[model samples]
Target: MRLNLPSVVLFALAVSLCSSPSLFGAEASADEKQADWIQLFNGKDLSGWTPKIRGHEYGENYADTFRVRDGLLVVSYDGYQPSDLMSMDKKGKKGFDKFGHLFYEDTFSHYLLRVEYRFVGEQVENGPGWAIRNNGLMLHGQDPSLMTLNQKFPVSIEVQLLGGNGKDERSTLNLCTPGTNVVLKGNLFEPHCTSSTSKTFHGDQWVTVEVEVRGSEVVRHKVGGDVVLEYSKPQLDPRDPEAKPLIVDGKILLDHGTISIQSESAPTEFRKIELLPLDDK
Candidate 1:
């Protein structure tokens, strides 16, 4: 059969397209793939970050506790007075609880978050005992603007970061529920904190932790590129006073929220904070 001029041109164009996949949907280039990760911490400054410290206003960086130094986001206590770091007393008085959280400006969900952190120096004078070498990455957290002036922690799921004293086997990459609970082993996990199977990280060495959060469906904690803890179904705990008011329809599922890093009296430094979004809002 003889083809018309238009048909012949169409056939030739189809043949050319089939031979060149790059014109349609080729694999992403290396630079393009790297761009997928949003560098939350710019390493030079706190450009897109805010601080909320207990007993202070949302934006107040009390005593310069949270600052950028040497290209690292650092939580230092050099500016705090010794008396300002007094421990809490029996009367539930936070003379200077000073619990602070550096929250990123935006909220996220269904993403992979990675951070490189290290605990250095010493805890502030008169700092609480439990807060030594203890810092946390607060995930799915309430907005800092909503936190009370005296609230110690935000209503969020905490990826607890701990360091060893060069002796005991203090594991890192644990979980601590401030005002939320998770489902583990197909049951509602009510405990406040649970340990992960990750190895103990001692000294001032840097440790990397990657968190895979898929809304309220599931979350995973990975250390050294290996998953050590997994859970699902994060919801507000009615028993928690701080979290009760947030319950909606008798249940407030934590599918997505803000992310923050804790001060909690520990001198910590974050070198890298990055996130890879898996879906659009």
Candidate 2:
């Protein structure tokens, strides 16, 4: 058999594409069952989501905070009125206090969520010093309707995604427990946040962050294909007065709840947010 150089190269490229999971979408080449994988975002509109932003009524988008543009789910603060702007430090530097979360209406246990996100544009004016390129996925979040109009964060486990500034090793898909606590291994892990083992992801490039959640039993964080962090037994923090109500029977186990994306003064875009249910029928 005689093979031309171009033909040989083409064959190799095709093989690489089949083996590549980062080509596009979340868990690009995962072992997901066809019927199990559900698309959360329709890539056209906010059909299945409800927005809750600070100072706005429940379901109010509060400045078109969550929008779909060109098949991407975008968290924007474009329509914020001047009165809505928070932290007016410098002229022309606009930051709004409308910390928001766009909640997926459904709740599920024992599922895997895969989201592809990238930071875009500048952070809103007067955004917290720690929220420049900060955005995240809130797992086991509280209901949007129950949240107060001024609540900063829901009682959930945050899969914190952050981008590098320029010369620092910042990691993505780290864990940030807001009003909650979790056991990292055999002992209880505290401090609100624990950095992941993944390398720093710089720039506005799209990054795939996946979470394998098996209720309060265990949860794993993965960046691309590498398993970066894993923890178990997520529970409401009794020490935090804000989360005390969620602790029932003197023991609060977060087995299931809603999922949401945060709008913490940063512009972020999610091109794909998909989930695969691991529960047996």
Pick by lDDT: which candidate is best? 1
lDDT of 2 at 50: 92
lDDT of 2 by residue, 47-118 (tens): 999988877788988778899999999988777666666545357565566688999989977898999999
**Mind sharing the TM-score for model 2?**
0.84
The C-alpha stretches of model 2 lying farther than 4 A from their native spots are 1-32, 87-96
The sequence of per-residue lDDT tens digits that candidate 1 reaches over residues 61-140 is: 99998899999999998898867766567796654477899999999889999899999988776677778899998999
Give me candidate 1's TM-score against the actual structure. Answer: 0.86
All candidates' lDDT scores? 0.90, 0.85
Candidate 2 residue-pair clash tally:
2
Clash counts per candidate, in order, are 0, 2
- Candidate 2 achieves a global lDDT of 0.85
Residue 2 CA displacement from its true place in model 1, Å: 38
Cα RMSD for candidates in order: 5.4, 8.2
Question: Where's the lowest-lDDT run of ten residues in candidate 2?
Answer: 24-33
